[model samples]
Structure formats: structure tokens, C-alpha cells
Target: MNPETIRRRRWYILGVLTFSLLVVVLDNTILNVALKTIADPQEGLGATQSQLEWAINSYTLVFAGLLFTFGVIGDRLGRKRVLVAGMVMFGLASLLSAYSQSPAQLIGARALMGLGGAAIMPQTLSIITNVFEPQERGRAIGIWSGAVGLAIGIGPITGGLLLAHFWWGSVFLINVPVIVVGAVLIALLVPESRNPDPGRLDPVGVLLSIVGLVTLSYGIIQGGERGAWLEPGVLGPIAAGLAVLALFARHEARSDHPAFDVRLFRDPRLSAAVAAIALCFFAAAGMFFFAGFYLQSVRGLSAFQSGAMLLPFAVAQILFSTRSAAMVHRFGAKAVCATGLLLVAAALASYPVLGIGTGTPLWVLGAVFFVQGAGMANVMPPATESVMSALPREKAGAGSALNNTARQVAVAMGVAVLGSVLASIYRGELAERLAALPPGARTVAAESIEGAHAVAERLGAAGQGLIGPANAAFTEAMRTAAGAAAVIAFLGALVVLKWMPGRTAHREPERAERAERAERGTGREKARGRRAASRERTRV
Candidate 1:
């Protein structure tokens, strides 16, 4: 497409990009509400807890593993081509998942969906960077980021509504129509862009990255499932993954045509922005993981109610994200990010207080969600803009990949670490109560709050005693996890305050204006001298 034509349709193109992103983001949150139904043997797939975990982990592993590789490929190939192909693959995988007869089938289909998602994600951000002017990029990105918040809030509610009327497959089936429409709009409105000087492929770096990320993600997922990290299954893979990633970094630094440019980290803007994103997501993802259990298991709310409670969060995102660019313009990225992280810390800190008892008002929890969402809305746009601005437009795909990779890795680590903390604390608190039960029952009940509830149901009258202790133990675990998350968020605030640049609006533009004035003055002086010389020659 021509430049003017692309400019004229940029807003429409952005809408299409956001719609495409919704399919990927919406699927994960929607699946959360379907887990219980999917676990039912008669109603849905008779998947065990381990199988269910794999259904999620399989997708996460594949998505995180191939994200950067696909980003590089998008830069070399055409972004529009990759994006359309991804949407098609994702739609087909959704169909397969909807018709899946077994947990294994669903897991396999989800992996294919992940492959498609990896292709889709980086292209959206890169395309936005290419299409929007620098001055408008932040505003555009804020809208893009808000779409994520919208998806999070709506996914469970959508799943609940679908499941109420139809089968478990309805959740997956819902993605098809959206994907089809988005694909068509993308073809019509979105312009194709690629790096004109995309260098040769780095197959070796690509292999190392996939191996390292998949192994690391597996280790993290395994650690969360096992609720321990010291064992060989967890530690061995983590160690191997780290070593391979180190090698990948070394190779990329030396390669003539690197798959990912390691030297980008040298720019403080890029590095700090990446750290802010990683840390923010790390804390947020862990909190969200546990919040579901709290709302449903502890508070006795249904899936639909829990989903409705998140509307405050969604509202906050919609209200604040679109205006964050103005905040950044006034206060600067460093101020906005640090203040936002502080708000996130404050919200996380409230979790321990609000989660003290099952009787705690739901409104209080909703208020906390609002604060957290608002904080996140302020942080993402500025950080993302900073990351994109640090690199030339041609390298936007790589930059987008780096931003997303950091988030994905941090999410894995957060879930693993915080989940481990929750499990340990819960088991310790419930140990005495569990010991009174039969050996197998005690083991199962000690595994998780849900497992405890299952055991209690089986024991009937005798198991009624387990419910109170289980709820108390789980609440205590949640408090501890929230506290830890609060600390991480506070640390993120400190990191941004120290490293992110301060108040560039007043200084950089002023300097440019001064330079322009000086050049104009010099031009005028030269013109006067030329006129004087011409007059003197004519008089002679």
C-alpha cells in the first residue's frame, strides 16, 4: 500500500490489529472458566489435574519458545503474510480443539494455536510502530494495550455465558468467527511491511532459543505443578536452559547476521523498559493466578460472578489506558512508570488485608482490582513506546519480540515461584488437619484447596470438618503470596525510578528549536552579506 493510503486507514488498521490480538488473549482467559467443565468425565473431557495443567503448559511452552523466532521471520518475510497465515492456523486449531475428544487431543490442538499466536503477536506491535508516527505511537499503543484489558475482563464472562447455553466446545468455537472476520479485515486494511535490509537467517541461534525457552518454560511449569524447585526434574532443566540461553546470547553477539540483536540491551531505555514490563507482568500474573481460587473456592462465588467482579478492572483499564499518553506527556515516562508501579504495589498489598476472611466484602476486592488495572494501564503504553523508540523502525519486530519474551518468561517464573510459596504454606497450615484423614485422602486433600474440597465431598459428614481448615489454610497461603508479589512490584518501582529517563519533553524539543533558530540566523546573515557584495560590485 502507498504511504498516504496507509496513513488514511491507520485507525481502521489499528482496529483490525486489536481485533486479531483479542482472539489470542481471549482464548486463555476463557479457558480458565472452562477448566472445571472440561475436568468432568460426563459433561466434558475426563482430564486429570496433571492433564489439565499440560493443556495449558503445552500452549505456553510452544508460544514462548517460538515467539522470537517468528518475530525474526516476520521481519525477513512480510508481516501481513505472517499475520494472515497465523490467523488461519489459529482458526483451524480452534476447530480442532472444539472437537477434541480427549485431553491429549486438546493439548495438541492448543500447541498448534500457540504456534499461530506466536506469529500474530509481534507483528501487531511492529506494524503499529511502522504505521504510526512517533508522536502518535504512544496513543495508538495505549489503545492496543487496553484491548488486552478488555479481553481479560470479558473472557471468563463470555465463557460462562457460552457454557450455560452450549457445550464446553463453545468456548473454542467462539474464536472462529472472530478470527475469520479479523483475517479478512487485516487483508483489506493492514499494509505489509518488512525490513528492506533483513540479514541472513541465523538457524543456529533460532534452534538455541527454541530449545532454551521451551526447556526453561517446562522447568517453570513443572516446578509449579510439583510445588518444589530443588528436585532434578525442575532444577536440571532450569540449569540446562539457562546455560543454553547464555550460549545463544554469546552467539547472537558474535554472529554477522544475528537472529536477535543482543546489543540492544546496551541502550538504557530499552533495558529499563523491558525490565519494567517483565516485573509488572511477573507480579500481576501471579496475583491473577491465585485470585481465581480465592473468588471461587474461598468466597463461594460462581464463575460468572467472579468474572463480573473483574468488570471494575476492565473499566479502569479502559478509562486510564487511553489517557496515559497525556500523563506521559505531562509527567514523563520515568515518573509515570514509577508511580504506576507504586500503585500496583499498594493494590497488591491490599490483597493480604482484603483476603483475611471469606466474609470480606467483594466490593473491596473490586476496588483493589481497579487500582491494579489503572496502574498497569499507565505503565504499559509508556514502557512499550520507550522500547519501540529505542530501535530504528526496521528492527521493530525484534524489539517487539524482546518485549514479549520478557513478559512470557516473567509470567512463567511468577506462577512457579508464587505457586510454590502458596502450596508450601497451605500444606504446612493444613498438615495437622489432613493427618486425621485416611492416608490417600490426606495426600489428596493436602495437594490444593480444590483437592481438599474433593476429598471432603467423598468423606461426606466426616469431611465437613476439612472445609473450614482448608479455607483457612488457603487464605493464609494467598496472603503470603500477595505480600511477596507486593514486594516484587515495589522493587520494580525502584528499578524504573533509577534507570528510566526523566522529563524529556521540556529539554529535547527546546534544544531542537534552538538549533533551528541558529541555522535560520546563519542563513539570514549569509544572505545579507551576499546582497552587500552585489551592491558594492554594481557601484564599482
Candidate 2:
């Protein structure tokens, strides 16, 4: 009955949601370390590179494709109900993934896991939006957002530890207990919430959106690795995907009961926040994706060793994020977010210039990653709080879906576009160096860093000279990607500063008025408080 009790309950609910989120986000990063183990010749599935790639991409493709559809479904039915179903589905799928005997089976299981994730992800934020008051929304979202970075930062470590001690299936099996625990907490603590006027689900809109997103994601994933950006296979699907997306937009604009609202983008704060999230993901995803290669290939760190070294990234976020909401409360989202993005940009820019041959490069990297993690922590919560604040309470589910879908697409694009840029640069640099090698060896050397290593092994001591040029090429590509990522982060910062409004427009004034009335003990204040309390009681 008291605000204090309700506040504590809210925080407890937040913890459950954070744990649920850890399950989903961990899947995104945890599998990366286990992929080789899963694909090993003797102990695991003898999966080809394509199969291994699909193990990751299939989940992404299905997840990104279905997010908006599931968000709407959750809104129309009930968020709590959908979220519970998702947990069950995710747990069962993880079981299947753990027991998969073939690459096809694992990929299929991952796709199912993604489907469950689509249902779960949007509901977490939307539920928080419905329950928390405006004043506390930022802090709630800050904790939730911090879970993402924390999970990501530690996922590889967790996976590495598991793989080092257990079978490859242990990674997938790990999700089972978490899902069971999360589901129990969800059923007990998380309140049901939904859109009052969710309207009918637009089947055509779902179909179009799914096709577009899936096709686009496929092109990006395949194109980045195969260097098929302009090829008909990649280009054709990409064009079709864009056209379908445009058709979906046009159709939604004309519909009386659209599946999701596109007009939300008209709100500059929401638009800017979404953009900021996307750009930040683009940078972070690309950075970590390739940085693994650089650290292992160029610096010669073992997988577990590299993962241990990245622990500070999580530590920085976990330490700083709880306080980020306070920063937003005091200095406002615009300033805090701008400073954070600029910090991320500066960190990205510093990566290329740090000399790898020097003794201090690892320390420099640790410092840079910590700064980058802290920056991302600041950016996520404040920006998300601003975005969710802009939407009507009834549209929270669909709106949250839109926000997440934008982020998922940005990561896919980052892996594609930034990766393409890096690959192109590496190929160009290696081309000159590989010219004198045998044609077969040149072909292998030019493909990837691993391929170059294989070529060097085949050539024996004669190939020792190739390692220098290969490392040089990879380093140059790192510089190019990081430089571009810096530009992206800086642009995001500028957008937040220029477009995202401060508390003048977003913060509620009633709380301050209520405080003053309580302090002064006015008769009218008491009367109004009784009425307000009654209304809150009825709502609760």
C-alpha cells in the first residue's frame, strides 16, 4: 500500500527481468567461444565453416525477423503471458540445442530459441515502462541495459570456462536452469500488462516485415564473409528486402489498424534515442567481432586468456551504470548521452594508434575497453529511458519492439558493412604481398587471417615472411574499422545533443508539486493526495 513497498517490489521484479535478459543476451555472445568446440572433428559435429556461421546467423535472422510481430502479439494478448511462454520455449529449445546430433538440428534449435527470444525481449522493457513511474524509469532501464553489456562482456568468459571443463553442449545446457528460475520468478513477481487498444494483428504486415528482415539479414551475414556485396545473390536479396520493407511501411501508413506505428519516429527524442542505440550497437558489435581475431591472431592470446582480459569491460559497465541514471537525473539525458558517445568515439579512435609491438598495448587496450564500456553504459539507459518516455503507455510493447529491432538490424549491418570494409582493406593489402606466392597458397592467404596462418604452415619456414604482411594487413583493417566506428559514435553524440530534449519536456512536474504540498501540509494537498492514492490503488 505504501510507495516504499511498491518500490521494493518493483526492484525485485527488475532483478528477475535482468536475469531473464542475461539468458537471451548471453546466447548472443556465449556461442562464439564454443563454435570451434562444437565443430571439432573428433569430439563434436564435423561442421563446415558455413554451418558454423549459420549456427549464429540463423538465430539472428529469425530473431530480427520476428521481433515486431511478437511485440504486437504480446501487446494484444498479454506481456506476462507471452513472456512466460517465451521462457518455456527458450528452455526447451536450449535442451534441443544441447542434444543436437547434426548441424541442421542445432541450427533449427537455435532458430527456435530466437523465436522465443523475440517474444521475451520486447516485453521486459514494456512491462517496466507500464509499472515504473517517470522519475524511476531511468534507473530501472539503466539496470536492465547494464545487464546486456555485462552479459556480453562476460559471455565469452563463461563459455570459455565451460568449454574448457566440459563438453561443447554444456554451453547450451546452461540456459536450462536459468530459464526455469526466470520462469518461476516471472510467474510470481512480474505483473501482467498489455495495450488497452492493441487493435487487430495485420497478417500482411507481419509477412512483409518478416520477409524483408530475414532477407536483408541473410544478405548481410553471407555477404560480409563471402565478399558478395555486389554479387547478384547478395544484391538481389538486398534489393528485394528493401523493397519489401518499403512496401510494409507504405502499407502500414495507409492502414487504419497498422501492426506497428511508424509515426513514432516523428518524435525527435525517440528518433534520436533509437539512432543512438543503433549506432552504438553498430560500433560495439563490429569492434568485439573483429577484435577477437586481432587479439588471438595478431597478439597470439589463447581464447580463455583473451576472454579473461576482457573482464574489465563488464566491470566498468556494472560499476558505472547504476549511477548513470543519477547522472541523467542531474545533468539530463542529452548531456550525459553526448559525453558517453564521445567517450566511446575517443576509445574507438585510440585503438588503431596503440602500437601492438609495444609492451603497453594490452594495458592500453584494457583502459580503452573500460572507457568504451562505461560510455556504452551511459548511452543505453538514458537514451532508452528517453525513448520509452516518448511513447504512450499503451504502445509500449510495439514501441519497445521497434527500438530493439532497430538495434538488431544495426548489429547485423555492422557485422556486414564494417566487416566488409575491413575485409576489403585486408584483401587489398594482402594482394600485393601474396602475388609472388603459389596460386593455391595465394588464394588461401588472401581469404582470411586463419587461412593465411594455414598457408604459412603449409609453406614451413619459407612462409615465415608472410606472417609480417598478414599481420600488417589485419592491423590496417582494424584501424580502418575502428576509425569508421569512431565517426559513427561521434555522429550519434552530435545527434543526441542536437535532437534529444532534456527534462524540460520529459520530466513530470506533479512530483515536485506533491512534495511541496506534503511539506506545507495544505488541506487541498491532503484532499488531492487521498484521491490520487485511491486512483493508484484501483490501478494496482
Root-mean-square deviation of every model:
4.0, 5.0
40-79, model 2: which lDDT tens digit per residue? 5466785644465567667766677677778888888899
**Per-residue CA lDDT of candidate 1, range 490-510, in tens?**
999998988888877323643
Candidate 1: residue 333 Cα off by (Å):
0.4
What C-alpha lDDT, on a 0 to 100 scale, does residue 195 get in candidate 1? 86
Most accurate candidate by TM-score: 1
Enumerate residue pairs that collide in model 2: none
